[model samples]
Target: MTVATARAHPNIALVKYWGKADAASNLPATGSLSMTLDIFPTTTTVRIVDRDLDRVVFNGAEREGTVRDRVVRFLDHVRLLAGREDRAEVITENTVPSAAGLASSASGFAALAQAASTAYGLALDDRSLSRLARRGSGSAARSVIPRFAVWHAGSDEQSFAEPVQAPPIEMVIATVDAREKAVSSRDAMQRTAMTSPFYPAWVTSTAQTLESALEACRSGDLERLGRITETNALRMHAAIQGSDPSIRYLTPRSWAIFDAVAQLRGEGVLAWATADAGPNVCVISPPEHTAAVAERIGALADVVIARPGPGVRLQETDA
Candidate 1:
C-alpha cells in the first residue's frame, strides 16, 4: 500500500477517566466524555517497509527504548488486523506537549491508528478504529470522534467511543507547565486503582458525571457542562491524592488559574477550569468572553483559545 497520513486533535475529558478495569486490555473502569480541541494536534504518517522491526520517529527524532517499544506494540495490533506481516516506518509530529497532561497521546495514537490502518489497507470503520486506538491509549478512543465523544466501558466490541449530542464550546487552555509530569497518567491511574481509598467513590461519581455531561451536551447547557468538567476533574485528582504515595499533578499555578476561573464565574462570565494529568488548566467558556478569560488567566500562565475540532481522518499525500 502507498503512504498514508492522518491527523487528530487532543481532547479534554468532561467526565474524567481515571482507572483501568483491565490493565492488559486497557479497559477503563468508568465511562468518559470529552471535547476535542482545535489546538494542539498530532499528525502521523505510516508506510509499510521491508524492515525486520517497526521504526518510529517523533518530531524529527528517532525514538528508542520504551517509546519505540510502545509504538511497535501498538503497531502490531494494526498489522494483525490488516493481515500484514511487514514492518512499518512511522513518523509523528505533535503540537501538544509530550507527557504534559494535554492529551497528546490521545491525538497521537488516534492519528497513528488511522494512518497505520490505512497504510496496511485496512478498511476499518470509525468505531473499529476507535477500538483499535484505545489499545494504545484509552483517551485516543474518544479522540476518534469529532467535537464530543463518550467512551463506554463494555467489552472490546461494545466499548467503542461514539459522538455525543453536544455542540461546540469555546476553550481556553492555560499552559501552566509544559514539562512532563513526575508520574505518567498510566502509572498514576494504575496506582489509584490499586491503592486509592476513594477509588470506588471516584468510579461511581464519574459514571454519574458522564450521564450528566451527555445530557448537558445534548441540551447545549454550557454552564452545566462546565460545572461537570471541573467537578469530574477535581474528583479524579482527589483519587490520585488518596493513593498510597499520592501523585500530585496540579501545581500552585494550576490552582491560581482555577481560582481565576472561579472568580470569573462569580462575576457571571461562565469561565470554568479542568486539569488533566498535568499542571496545565483548560477553561471552558463562551466565545464572547474567551478573550477576557484568557487575559485573566494569562497573568498566571500562557493561554491558547480553541474550539471543537474534527476527529481522526486520513489524507492523501501531495506526491
Candidate 2:
C-alpha cells in the first residue's frame, strides 16, 4: 500500500497541563489551553508494511533504542484501532527544535495519529483523532485543532479537545537554547507530580485562570489573555521548581527575555512571555507588535513570529 501523509503544527500552552492523573493513559490532571503555531510543524507518513515489526525513520535518520521502541508502540495504537495488527513503516520530519519547550512531540504524535489512522482505513473524526493523539503525548490533544484549543481532563471518550471560537493571536517565540533539554518533559512532569508540594495549589489556580483566559479570548482582550498565559506558565514552572532536588528549565537567557518582555510592556507593547519544560520563551502579543517583539527578543536569542496555524491535515492516503 502507498503511504498516508499528514502535517501538524506545534502548540504552545497558555493554560498549561504539567502533570498527569493517569500516566499510562496520558490523561492530564487538569485541562490545558494552547495556541498552535504556524512556524514549526511535523510532517509524517505512515504505511502498512510487510515486515514483522514497525520501521521508523525520523528526520532522514532511522531512529533506534528507546525512541524507536516508543514510536513503534505509538504505531501499535493505529494497528489496534483498525483491528489489524500490521506493522507500519513510519517517517517523520520535525521542523520544531526538539525538546526545547516547543511542543515538538505534540505535532509529531498528532501527525502520526492522523496519518496512521487514515492509512489503516479508520475514518476518525477530529475528537477521536485528538483522543488517539493524546495516547502518545498528552499535549498532542490540543495540537489536533488550530487557533486555540482546550484539552479537558476526563475519561478517554470525554477528554478530547475542541477549538475555541476566538480571534487568532500571534506569538513571538524566542529560542534561548535550541539544544534539547537534559530532562525530557515526560520525566520532569512525573517527578514534579510526585515531589512538588505545590502541585495541588497550581491545579486550583489553573482552573480559575482557564475560565478567565477563555473569557479574554472571547472578548479579544489580548492583554488579559497574555497575562493569563504568562502567569499560568509561571505557576506550572513554580510547581516544578519546588520539587525535591528540583527541575529548572529556565536559563539566564530565558529570564533575559522575560526582562525584555517587561520592558516591551512598559513601552506599550503587549508582549507577554510563557514557557514550558525548556528554556525557550514564547511571547504572546497582538499582530501589530509581533515584529517589534521579535526584534526585541532577537537580541537575546533566535526569534520567530508565528500566527495561528491549521489543524492536522491528512494530505495523502492510499487504500
Q: TM-scores, in order shown?
A: 0.97, 0.97
* lDDT, candidate 2, 92-208, per-residue tens: 998999988899999999999999888888899999999999999999988999888989997888888999965557898888888989999999988888899999898788878
| CA lDDT, every model vs. true structure | 0.89, 0.88
Report how far off residue 311 is in candidate 2 (Å): 0.5
- lDDT of candidate model 1 versus the reference: 0.89
- Please identify model 1 stretches exceeding 4 Å from their true place: none
| Candidate 2 structure lDDT | 0.88
Q: Tens-digit lDDT track for model 1 on 15-41?
A: 888888887668888899988988888
